[model samples]
Target: MTLTLTQTAAEAVKQIVARVPQAEDGGVRIRDTGAPSGFELSVAPDPEPQDTIVVTDGARVFLDEVAAASLEDRILDAELAQDGSVRFALGSQV
Candidate 1:
């Protein structure tokens, strides 16, 4: 359930969290849906049992139970599309 934060994603998450209330408790969750590409990332209010990485600010990022038991390494990257949309990608380092 290791997660990497790209400069773009870290900056964006920092900005968005700053604007929203209760964001201090919320975080971005990354998980592998067992897809062919790699993994899928989801944004939600913390994690229960289905979350991979529970990111809390720039201080700490961790792997949830499920994800930790599954993937060993993962990278969270940010991409800027031609349509002016920013997207996130998660891939297994293994």
Candidate 2:
């Protein structure tokens, strides 16, 4: 199983990565923070050697080892606030 991203989420990620000039070839990276959500999102110019890369609609998302396992059966969704903030949510893949 592998982590998946909704089209909305992909677009959101694409938008984020577009803002980072250095991350042109990069995208959004999801890491295991071991916190409440046990996850964090950031712009990564490149992926770690062990990272799991998932690309959807030309949007690339890098999932760290722990995050990859944790989200393998999950789907990532996103919502953009009026202020241009991105809110990400994880849901079971159906």
| Candidate 2 regions with alpha-carbon error over 4 angstroms | none
Q: lDDT per residue, candidate 1, 1-94, as tens digits?
A: 3556666767556554454566565655555566677555444556655545434347223355555666456565667566655676666665
In candidate 1, what residue range of length 10 has the lowest lDDT sum? 53-62
- Cα RMSD for candidates in order: 4.2, 1.0
Model 2, range 4-90, lDDT digits (tens) per residue? 889999999999999999999898999999899578889999999999999999999999999998898999999988888888898
lDDT against the true structure, per candidate, is 0.55, 0.92
Q: Please, what is the TM-score per model?
A: 0.52, 0.94
Q: How many residue pairs clash in each candidate?
A: 0, 0
**Model 2 TM:** 0.94
